[model samples]
Target: MNSTLWIVRVVLAVVFLASGTAMLTLSRARMIARLGAWIEAVPIGAVRLLGALEVLAAIGLVVPPLVGIAPMLAAAAASGVFLVMVGAIVLHAREREYLQVVMNLALAAMAVFATWGQLAS
Candidate 1:
């Protein structure tokens, strides 16, 4: 279970880090434009900020655990990802993008599981 949880943490951390960086830097304009049409929501600046937060969380997930400096950071980072997914679900729902909502929910569940496992161990 510990090994499985570690693998999940690494995979999720890499994914979230890469995706968040892309969203923050490369895809900011496109994302904001698409999301803007819905609720004038998620300003460009806010998107960038969120992206930064994700990157930080991604680092938290991987670094502390591997370095043996408070493994709790890993769980906290997973929790942050879960919170971000929650926001994503809400944003997608408001946009009437049901597919995205489902995807976000799935990601949130995975994050929650990872968090639970890390904290448990």
Candidate 2:
């Protein structure tokens, strides 16, 4: 079970880090091209802020635990992920992007699991 939690942590960390970096680096036009026109509905600054928060959440998921400092941060990070995913799900649903909503649901489930596991441990 501990191993499973660790795997979840690592996977979430890597995925969010990469995703946030892309969001931070990509221009509005490029993001629209790659991610679809849905991105244009969101302000670029808000996108960047979300990206930054994601990067922090990614770090908070693993680093504190690994360092034996404030391990509770992992739970907090997972909670944050879950919250962000909720927003994403709403946005995707509003846009009628069912596929993206599905993906968001999966991530939210994972985040919830991670949060529970972290708190349990």
Candidate 3:
């Protein structure tokens, strides 16, 4: 169970880090090109805010637990990511991006599992 949670944490951290970094660094045109029309609908500042939150949440998911600080923060961070996934699902669904919605659902489930497992332990 611990091993599985660790794997999930690492995988999710990597994914969110990469995704956040891209959002932070990329120009609107590039983001739109890579992410599709969704980027066009959201304000640039809002997009940047989302990027910052994602990066922070990614760090939160790993650091506190690894360093033996507030380890329970990992569960909180997972819950935060779960909220983000919920938002993603809503936006994707509104846009009729069923594929993205499916991806969000999978990620959201992982987030829930990570949080639940960690808190239970």
lDDT of 1: 0.81
User: Which one wins by lDDT: 1 or 2?
Assistant: 2
Which 10-residue span in candidate 1 carries the lowest summed lDDT? Answer: 31-40
Best by lDDT: 3
- Pull out the clashing pairs in model 2: none
Question: How much does candidate 1 score in TM-score?
Answer: 0.85
| Poorly placed runs, candidate 2 (over 4 Å) | none
Tens digits of per-residue lDDT, candidate 3, 21-98, equal 878999999988877678877999999999998899899899988999998999999999999999999999999999
lDDT of 1 by residue, 1-121 (tens): 9788878788888878876686676664566555444334656677678879988988988899899999898899999999999988888898888987887888898899989998888
Between candidates 2 and 3, the lDDT winner: 3
Backbone clashes in model 1: 0
**Candidate 2 residue-wise lDDT, 33-83, digit = tens:** 866667888988899998899999999999998999999999999999999
**lDDT for each candidate structure:** 0.81, 0.89, 0.90
Question: Worst lDDT window (10 residues) for model 2?
Answer: 30-39
How well does candidate 3 score on lDDT at residue 114?
87
Poorest 10 consecutive residues by lDDT, candidate 3: 32-41
